[model samples]
Target chain A: MNNSSDPKKYKNSFLNWIEFRLPIVSYIEREYKDYPMPKNCNYFWSFGAMATILLVVLIVTGIFLAMNYTPHTDLAFNSVERIMRDVNYGWLLRYLHSNGAAFFFIVVYIHIMRGMYYGSYKYPRELNWILGVFIFLLMMATAFLGYTLPWGQMSYWGATVITNLFSAIPVIGEGLKTWILGDYTVGNATLNRFFALHYVLPFVIFGVVALHVAAVHVHGSNNPSGIDIKSKNDTVNFFPYMIIKDTLAICVFGFIIAAVVFFGPNLMAEVDNYIPANPMVTPSHIVANWYLAPFYAILRAVPDKLGGVALMFASILILFFLPWLDRVKIRSCNYRPIFKWFMMLFFVNFFVLGYVGMKPAEGIYLLVARMGLIYYFVFLLLITPFIGRIEKTKKLPLSISNILNNNHSEQNKFQKEVN
Target chain B: MRFIFTILFCFTFCFSIFAASETKNAPKHEWSFTGLNGTFDKSAIQRGYKVYREVCAGCHSMNLLYYRDLIDIGFTNDEIKAIASEYTVIDGPNDEGEMFERPAKSFDRFVSPYLNEQEARYSNNGSYPPDLSVITKAKINGPDYIYNLLLGYVDPPEDFELGDGMYYNKWKEGEQIAMAQPLDEGYVDYDDGTENSLEQLAEDVTTFLVWSAEPELEERKSLGIKVLLFFVVAGLFVFIAKNRLWKSVN
Candidate 1:
């Protein structure tokens, strides 16, 4: 069935033979090596590669930890202790897994933020963005389930608080909560089901991630200039150039994670989590891990329980509509002036919400959190849609190559003048 | 609509500020093992073990630790065996199929004070004594909190009211606790000629609890230093390689 116009008519014989049978090797070469990418894509683009590497690190380390972990309530804590003290390199494996989770979230957040800043969610790339949002939601579910496997006080109580939120529903809510727990409380059954789901969800994330990459390849990458590629001069092969840069970024990221794992593994960990789970004794202050803190703040800001749950969920669901929400033709914030300021404000509001979530739900912290919550929704729903139509964007570059090779010095001078 | 929402949000916060008045901030205390290079003081850990045996052991159980684990804290094999034999543990069924009590072996965990949770709560007037195996690592500012709690007890201010079985302490939540003043000056006699005072006992016991909570702390810190060094070197090489690879690009 090989056509006369086929590019691979006289290719490597081994690859041609494989392609004639399965086409798997040809598929990899087409998708990964021959894939044209914007040469102007910055280091921010590297975080996606970093996140994928961390996902693999987490899965490998998680499996080893599961081999040593016991799901029973009575033995779970002791089993973890045994893993720390008795098992060979067990402590190292556990630390790497835990710290790897934290680093994974960090890289994923950067990756998501990069997409937003470059307006990668717009137009033809919308499906890719939607798939990414799904991957993120799955990551959240996996993280929540994995956190409970340790059976620490935070694990137990965090599970209880999150599951009990489902009971805020009128009729099916209570049933759903019980079904989730498999009992009236977060106990041995809850831990078992969570462990089972935690193990399964990562593979599901891996599947969705495959779709995400495929979508990225289908639409091509959005770059800093927000200009489409015109010819071969404006693009680069995905093999040696981008691949080498991605490896360098991953190495540096890995070094930072290793330092944290080895020296102060518990720095980000809550001390209260070291305590064994005691259902009767609730911790005086209950908060989620840092990754979940922003949404946790959103959940707590609303006065009513059901309203809070709805809003907390809506915070994530809102991301799905982002492609339509910001109806601008240009992708990158570098061109959209007013949108750029709001984006920075959005970033600040998120961190502020996180800080407030860590505080007791009272006094000045509560007030600040409430204000931050309002701004978050307003920015996403009202501002993002309308601002694009009114904002006067900068003049577009003809192509990435034009900007890079010709206007490089002139662009720097213009930016300096604008500042 | 957005304006109205912002107004309602602001009004809600005006009321919330009054509700957020009190916060319980745990006080920080200086310890020998606070930083990257910090190591647990061996003698302090041994003294802390003595305090635990004398006072805390009556209520709290360190179920994760075995008698043999004490060897790292300077206890000899014979001493650990002697210590283990002090408690009676239910061993096994004999030829007649009867279970009998026998002295604990060195490998056995510290014998729990009560048989089960129901019994433990009943003896403590409904407030269960938590497991102390990881107590120092489990609580926020656990080392400082434990040390302060030991010395924080005082007569309640005349107007202050306490519930039945509750005692006054400066650092406890609500300024009251179920546990009475546990440590006193010269409570546990130190055979090493160290003076036994409330502060000394508190310090020693805190150190011991930290060790129990993280016995691998010393090894972890040393290994961490080595691993970090290796990463730094390897990272430099990778950086150079990546630079060379990209040299051909515009």
Candidate 2:
């Protein structure tokens, strides 16, 4: 308050004084305030900002939930009931934190799809994409661990099945499984440790997200055309341009989320989760949550236990190597006619695997899951690398500005004629 | 590429509608406490509470509710006080370090039927009845499940051998259940002069259970309406602002 700096130009004097010392304002201004963004980037680009906002929502709601939650085997289930019944707005907080996990994954998945579709993982942006995959891996762990904190039937059995996956390891697997559970089964010790871990993993994710953003800023964002930004005409300031678009996306996204949170809070939830965890009686059907279901499907695609576990872990780990996997010169699928179809097929196959994961590992569903699994591996490991070499490439756009002008010229002949 | 996704979304939606019909012989019953605009019928809830108190309370326990929560189902303060006084709860150790029984208060939890799961199992022939606190939330189409279950008891088919304690329930997964028929005609004499048939009892009890499980349902839906309305208005301005911001770009 007593800073000697002139207050005439500064609306917030303390912030200006702090900025003189730390220079954070200038740093942010350099990195983002006037950051150049591709003018042609579409609604797909909005998801990255949306993911960041949802992460904050999850963290805020999660902290409140953790305050009311009990992490003991004897009291966990009843404590959750108490929270729903007694605590003020505890139901709202619980539902938001629970459903926010799904929403977060939805945004992140779309963000990744955008990355994949435009080959944003290529060239100088490879590290940014790898950092993103790490964040995803951390998110899955956090979500799984948080689910166990409720101590419901689905939470207990899901933890039991997933932990047992480690037992399929060659020799040290059995020891690792016991070490993870702190007992022979998912019990008090497992729940307590999971509570501790879930509380901490989000901070780790936040740190990684910081690095991911830094890496993206190093080379600026990849554009829709997948071409380099050549001059000022090719891009616009991110502040008023991208920020306004993101505000609108957030409103629309928040509206959809409110609809779910308010009206159909339990639509995607497992019914068995409402029951207290009972080791004596197993539920008729056991399944993972929707976000993790595709990998769960890949796990069940194999007959052997060890093989399934290996494939499941391999499926996620393979994304780290995606930068080198698809060696295509053209980035955007819009310009790559043949490769475009394969990419779309892969995207739909992901949803198929998710559905298959929910069904009983029966005849038809099992067959589809296996086929999807095989196609998944074949696309990344086999087709993507070789197709770039054989497929005929389309003519490349000279520049981002040139591409948009061509589109505009076709749409608005009067404006171009007047100009 | 976009076309494929559109088809995938439609296919998944149709599959979801198909999957919702897999309740297996249990028809979806209309309830006063279901759907977007649904609210608990106060009279039905009053009758349902009577059925729960007289019949189901003997086997299962609603351990989550307080005596005071009865106010939501149309009980007055005087009636709640009178109802609570009929039961005794183990309160605390007195000066002598011995726990003593006292008349339950409006704030006290509903008295459970059994002292513990062990007692519940032993008395019920090694099969413990589950808690009814969130039983409606614990099963798919829970009101329908409970209502149909009360009506599901039947004779076994040819060549089917019933276990010593098990009863035949066609709606059950294995067609064998440890729980016998828990409801009968005119089980509880309703004070409201309503019908006391078995089906009426089942429907009323199911309605009360839905309210018990989701006491916040009405508030949630009403708030949802206001929140979504505000969002729609906010969305319009946001869309306009977004369009103006992007007008300079392609």
Candidate 3:
């Protein structure tokens, strides 16, 4: 064995450890050192940090839930109830787990929109954008699977409908469906598999998230100007500056989550989920968890199952091509005249579709959903590319500093006029 | 100012009307199973427990419940301890220095198969055993649904044909149930010398399962009342705080 306190050897080991750890923190600080962030990057930027905190909260709460959760079909629903009623602080645990999911989606949506408004998907940062899309997809899958573990009517029937969608394939439709089900239908077999996948997928998402942050670190965050941050003078360190802002945002978000948990624990959950699953009867409305409602609406908007599934997928996948499809040189809608209005209309259209999705798919609601679905596709595929090229844009300030300088000049002129 | 006030008044009136109408028009489905009403039946729960132990326990597991839970569910201590002793053992810091794994203790719950993911799935034709603790709540239909499903399975009509690998049962409308109802008359010889009928066994097990699902239903309902009281107090405090804080500003 080596001597316990050889100075040279000790020095070498210390150096090795530092060499491994130093680059990560220093690299983050070094790369972001002069990277100009928007002075106007308000509470929106906090969503990303809030999303990060929510993810951590979810993983921790999920672990505790897993400890008490019985994954068997006969026992899974009962185990959840047991957690709520029997286990020590089981109610709090269940409340935290369920509400944490809602908060996670809320923060993530805001985070993604923050990226959208600021053109965070533009060149060099495209990988980060794609990773985010991937994360969103994984999150959706995880949530869907997690929801099914309860084997409630919604969980069972929802899985049945979703897994059966694989049967839409032309040749191997039935076979594929059977393969996915691992049985004749969405029974114990399906529930068991979903449980396994639900547990496994989150860790996979965590891996992808690691890559996402790494990519974001590599390219750096895109500000509202969409200009290269390296070219500007006003910049701050990620640790103290961004960290502090993120912490404050997290506190506010925590307040919101606490309020939901304390006052209205089941506000976001459906009442039907309180019951056990029976395949013989279906619920009146088979809606997914709230995070998935937007896409579910798009799916229902189409008349054909295959077509609806395709459209629903395209709705999300369309976001992946945004960096390239958007031809406009400018990033933010704040400066884009015509594009700004279109973006607002598109947001409202999507919300309308969400509303229509929750309603029975018939009569006026169907018509509304169809119309909203058309706009949903048009906004992404046609309008995004078309507007990017055709819209006449105003000349943007060379940098954030230039915008500030112009504002100062304009203020001085107003004072002179007043005098 | 009058026009603005009138518009606000109209909007509030319309909103309230809409809300009231929506609530009234909300769909009400048949919620009761077996058309039975009142508090849960303890006898039914006891029967359900029997059905679970004899039938479902062979394949499915409820690893969350301890032997002691039976006592809470209306079983005698002697009966529970007897059942527990048959299944598990206790060994710790006794006169003997050696560690021993013996029959389960009265406090011990059912143990799941100690199979890992790969092993569990492989043994069950690519399906893992799910824990039963929360299955009732996880499903969309409540206990009635589970009960209906359990009793739904029957032999298919003579003209009906099931596809390959599909098992036909008359109880299910689709003519297939993954699980064959394990409860049959006289399947288990009751320890307490009670005559065990299939229907009686099924009802008992279902009740037991429901109890296991929500052991603290009574506690939760009472706690809900307490929480509502707290909210009432908090609301009043908030009202006072708002008045005090905004008094000078107004």
If both were scored by DockQ, which would come out higher, candidate 1 or candidate 3?
A: 1
Which ten-residue region of model 2 chain B has the weakest summed lDDT? Answer: B1-10
TM-score of 1: 0.89
Task: Give per-residue CA lDDT, model 1, range B28-51, as digits (tens).
Answer: 679998787789999999999999
- In candidate 2, stretches whose alpha carbon ends up further than 4 angstroms from where it belongs are A1-12, A413-419, B1-21, B155-160
Could you say which candidate leads in DockQ?
Answer: 2
**lDDT at A63 for candidate 3?**
84
Error of 3 at A255 (Å): 0.6
- lDDT by residue for model 1 (A174-259), tens: 99999999999899899999999999899999999988998888868889887788988888889867887787676666667776
**Candidate 2, residue A308: how far the Cα is off, in Å:** 1.2
- Judged by DockQ cut-offs, is candidate 2 incorrect, acceptable, medium or high? medium
Give me the overall lDDT of model 3. Answer: 0.69
Candidates in order, TM-scores: namely 0.89, 0.94, 0.64
Candidate 3 ranges beyond 4 A from true positions: A1-17, A20-25, A28-36, A230-232, A405-419, B1-22, B25-250
Work out candidate 2's RMSD over C-alphas. Answer: 2.9
Candidate 3, CAPRI quality class derived from DockQ: incorrect
- Where does candidate 2 chain A have its weakest 10-residue lDDT segment? A1-10
lDDT of 2 at A363: 98
